[model samples]
Target: MATSISPLEVADCEVLHAIEQQAHSHPWSLPTIQSCFGGLYHNIGLYEANEIVGFAIVQQVIDEATLMDICVSPACQGKGYGKQLLKQVLEQAQHRGVKIMMLEVRASNQAAIALYLKLGFTETYRREGYYPTESGREDAIMMELTLT
Candidate 1:
């Protein structure tokens, strides 16, 4: 399996959105994904055999970066690809002089929460009824990692 991580361009938005739809229950719209290009955003793609398997979107503002989104193809999940992608993103952010990384995850997503914890992120707080759910709204756990 030939795998590589590279910076992603706006041209890859369709692919990113497709993977997002596959991996998330309520994925971001294509327009939303496309709008992340340029400026403060730094996106990366995880490819295997020259095909995209996962991706992460991060936005930096001075010393802080927010992990806006990350998703691995459902077909490629549970094989450590998500962790690999996140690790690469974190490294890149730190190299770019970012002092802190932050992200929000659905409170119901135990797998993602565990992954974040393994990556050294601590729960800072929670926003009640932050994300919409089938039944109603769900809380969003805010996690942060101090890279310095």
Candidate 2:
């Protein structure tokens, strides 16, 4: 029974950071995560009952939405939390009149790449050496989804 919580809550940071460290080998720093407040950033958490299960961080500029980060606790992966988080973002987009959704992912992350593709996102470009990896660097696959 995952639940959703406000990312702006101070206490929620610890839970978010914990899940982030558990989910990403190179997770975004707590400060970097905080910097997402766009003065209007839309970051959401997935919870069950009262436990934080996953999260999605995103921002918008006019009619476009750029997904900055996302993660689901390893223990809860494959439980639809990721999809739910993404759906929330899309709903936010629709509410804000966003026409396109965009994001970049490490080329090596086949599972996430497949998920994005399955969600109707199309590869539009790639940014080489966009992420640091055990193998040095990885390309960032740019993907976009049209809202209407």
Candidate 3:
């Protein structure tokens, strides 16, 4: 069992891309993923059996951190991998001295919202017309966690 987390390398782009594509209906572009590890943010990959299983991207601005993206491979979803990944990411952020963690999820993504709440995040506000939806725009529910 190769369950471990490592700082994502440029070489891990393909795996992250694959996981993103598989997990999101509106997947992020390759350039966006590359930009995450391009010196502006911190990115981590969850590896198992020498392969990537999930990833989290976080951008730090002073004491605040924005969890830009987090996703588990479609095949790995519902197996507690997402939970583990989220906990690890939060721990890492706290260890880095980040005081707050925030992220936005589509209002319809009940699973993600539930997980965030279970992890101590509270709803902050809603961003109307924030994300692209099949029909017009979808509201984004903002969630925040205070590490300290």
Candidate 4:
């Protein structure tokens, strides 16, 4: 299937929120997602047949960028859409002259860690009990990819 990446618009908020709620155990609130617009944030959507299948939100400051949130629709998982979304975000960051990219993932998210590693990200630090979980809290693994 052919997929295209484009800047996320206000009209996409509801669809992206629905995807996020379906894709993650703890999804960002609609207001939080909406706040990604304007500012120094870049929000991109992966469209398949004019519908958003995946999305990413990145915040950039000077030469650095942070991958704040990324998700693929529940029905679209395991089909490389997440990777494509991340790739697009990386390309956008590089195009904007971002020198480094960083993100934090739940320590239990081995799949995401593996993907990041495969895409040239390195583990930089760990935050103990940074994420709330069903069983108390979970650690957060911090990773970074140097674009320069």
Candidate 5:
């Protein structure tokens, strides 16, 4: 199916939240997802036939942006939707004058790490035991992409 990227609307939160829950073992609360709708946050949704299949949330500060959260519905995973959403986020950040984009992924998320690396992001740091896991906690790998 052809997918298009667009700004996430308030009405889209419920579906996005549902997708998030299915996409992650520890999903953001609905309130947390709703909070990204305003302020310095940029939320974009990947729509297939007007239904959200993936989304990315980013926050900008000065010349830098943080990719706060990104996910593609489990049913829609591995079909390049994640990459497309990420590219849209990067383009939007660059258009907003952001010079760098940063994100943290669970150290065990090799798929995500590979994708980030494929998109020119380099490992910048690591936060030990930064994310909760079934076995207690997991490290977070911080990655950065210089856009300017």
Candidate 6:
């Protein structure tokens, strides 16, 4: 499968929303997703044969960058697309002189935490009850990768 990564724009929000809904238990509202199109945020889409299969949203401020969100289509999960997409984001951030990359993940998301760890991120701390869950609230594990 021929795959590619490309910068995404506001026009791509609907497609992103679709994938977000499929991949996340509590997905962002379309308007919330739409608000990330510009400014300090740089969004990217992962495509296979020119069709979007995943996406990531990252925000940069000076030397620090935060990975705000990432998702691969449920059907496309476990194929390493998430890793590829995240690696691309890291590369782009490094190219722009970003010194550190940070992110927060649900404590229950072992797959995501493992992926982050594999990419050199180290857990820094945790926020208890930071994310709402069906049962109650879940902790948010904060991780960071030093790029410089």
Residue range 1-148, candidate 4, lDDT tens digits: 8889899887899999999999888889999999988879899999989889999999999999999999999898898998988988998899999999999999999889999999999999999999998879999999999996
Q: What's every prediction's RMSD, in angstroms?
A: 0.7, 1.7, 1.2, 0.9, 0.8, 0.7
Clashing pairs in 4: none
After superposition, the stretches of candidate 3 with alpha carbons farther than 4 Å from their true spots are: none
lDDT (Cα, 0-100) at 77 in candidate 6: 92
Candidate 5, pairs of clashing residues = none
lDDT values for all models: 0.95, 0.83, 0.89, 0.92, 0.93, 0.95
TM for every model, in the order presented, reads 0.98, 0.91, 0.95, 0.96, 0.97, 0.98
lDDT of 1 at 101: 99
Clashes by residue pair, model 2: 1-48, 2-47, 2-48, 3-47, 3-48
Model 2 stretches with alpha carbons more than 4 Å out? 2-11
> Per-residue lDDT for 1-148 in model 1, tens only?
6689999999999999999999998999999999999989999999998999999999999999999999999999988998999999999998999999999999999999999999999999999999999999999999999997
In model 2, how large is the Cα lDDT of residue 77? Answer: 91
What is candidate 4's local distance difference test score? Answer: 0.92
Give the Cα-based TM-score of candidate 6 against the true structure. 0.98
Clashing pairs for predicted structure model 3, backbone only: none
lDDT of 4 at 89: 91
- Per the 3 Å backbone cut-off, how many clashing residue pairs does candidate 1 have? 0
Tens-place lDDT digits, model 2, residues 78-120: 8777887888888877888989999999998898998899889
Clash list (residue pairs), candidate 6: none
Q: Give the winner by TM-score: 3 or 4.
A: 4
Candidate 1: list runs displaced more than 4 Å.
none
Q: Roughly what TM-score does model 2 have, to 2 decimal places?
A: 0.91
Candidate 3: tens digits of C-alpha lDDT, residues 97-116: 99999999999899999999
Query: What TM-score would you give candidate 5 relative to the actual structure?
Result: 0.97
- Regions more than 4 Å wrong, model 6: none
Instruction: List pairs with backbone clashes in candidate 1.
Output: none
